[model samples]
Target: MNQYLLNGKLTAKPGHQEALAAILFQASKLVATAKGCRLYVIGKDKADSHSVYVTEIWDSKEDHDNSLKVEGVRELITQAMPLLDGPPAKGQELEIIGGTEI
Candidate 1:
């Protein structure tokens, strides 16, 4: 199957990286049981202290989009808004050709 992959970056306001990471971590929990969710890994950017990255894999792009409807997701998004340095940049969408089991 051709899986959907997204690499998203979020830049927190000064001193809010931990807070933003916390919110995203909470979101990871909320989506843990979401349909088609395979992997959702959070990472910190070594060069940019304010940046956090979320890498996700889903069965399909539709499944990824539908994840937004999962319970508490919207709320988490709302909670994350003010912590951002500015509007988030679009996530990088990747076409998965091959990979080891997730």
Candidate 2:
């Protein structure tokens, strides 16, 4: 099995902090339970409400691809549409073998 990760940075629309947080909260929940998902989280940038981070883990590239077809995943993306200041960027990743604790 291969694990896949996505790291996204988001910036909210002007004066839309609350809206962005609300959507992020709901979308986190939606993504956490999506098929093939191992983990999903939304995090603040520590500098501004407009800046945020989203990290996700999937069981495999195929699983990640399949999850885009899930209803919850679709809804989460749709919910996020109005809150973003720019298009999100994502990366596929592999973990470094020695970078974890037992």
Candidate 3:
């Protein structure tokens, strides 16, 4: 099986983790039904109360890229941009070496 993983970090304004998390959670609802999306998770940084992370697993990179073109997802991205301290940082793209689901 082929898999694509993306990790993104969003630094929210001070005391805005809850608001940022809410948007992320709402985005997750849309991602949950996205084609080829395997896993879409949002988590808070353990040490930083104003940071949030999004972890996504997809069947392919193309599927993941296509997701961005989705109207709802695009809207969510727009909504999330202002809440972030800066541009969302992109992490390394990882190949799934192994996982319980596989």
Candidate 4:
């Protein structure tokens, strides 16, 4: 099976980190139900309270792209925009070499 990974950061506007994290956590639950989602983990940066990190593993690149189309996923993205400090952090797409099963 083809596997894809996304590791990125999201910076929240001042005093909005907790709110953003909550939204991300909610999105994680929604992503868990996605067909090809293997893992969706969200983390907060200790040094920067306004920064959040996300790590996702999908069965394929297509799966990852399609996830964005999910209604709940889309809603979360919309809800997060206003809390974001700027655009989401740029991330690299990696072909998963190996990983433990979810």
Best by lDDT: 1
lDDT of 2 at 9: 75
**Global lDDT of each candidate:** 0.94, 0.71, 0.85, 0.88
In model 1, what are the clashing residue pairs, if there are any? none
TM-scores of the models, in the order given: 0.96, 0.74, 0.91, 0.91
Model 4 C-alpha lDDT versus the unseen true structure = 0.88
Worst 10 residues of 3 by lDDT: 93-102
Candidate 1, 2-84: lDDT as tens digits: 99999999999999999999999999998879999999989997889999999999999999999999989999999999999
In order of listing, the candidates' clash counts read 0, 0, 0, 0
Candidates 2 and 4, the one with greater TM-score: 4
- Residue 15 accuracy (lDDT) in model 2: 82
**Worst ten in a row by lDDT for model 4:** 93-102
Order by TM-score, highest first: 1, 4, 3, 2
Per-residue accuracy of model 2 over 34-79 as CA lDDT, tens digit each: 7678777777866786767767777766776776776676776787
lDDT of 3 by residue, 1-102 (tens): 679999878899887789889988988888788889999899876788889888999989998898887668888888888888878777778888786772
Error of 4 at 17 (Å): 0.3
Cα-lDDT of candidate 3: 0.85
Question: In terms of TM-score, which candidate is strongest?
Answer: 1
Q: Which segments of model 1 are wrong by more than 4 Å?
A: none
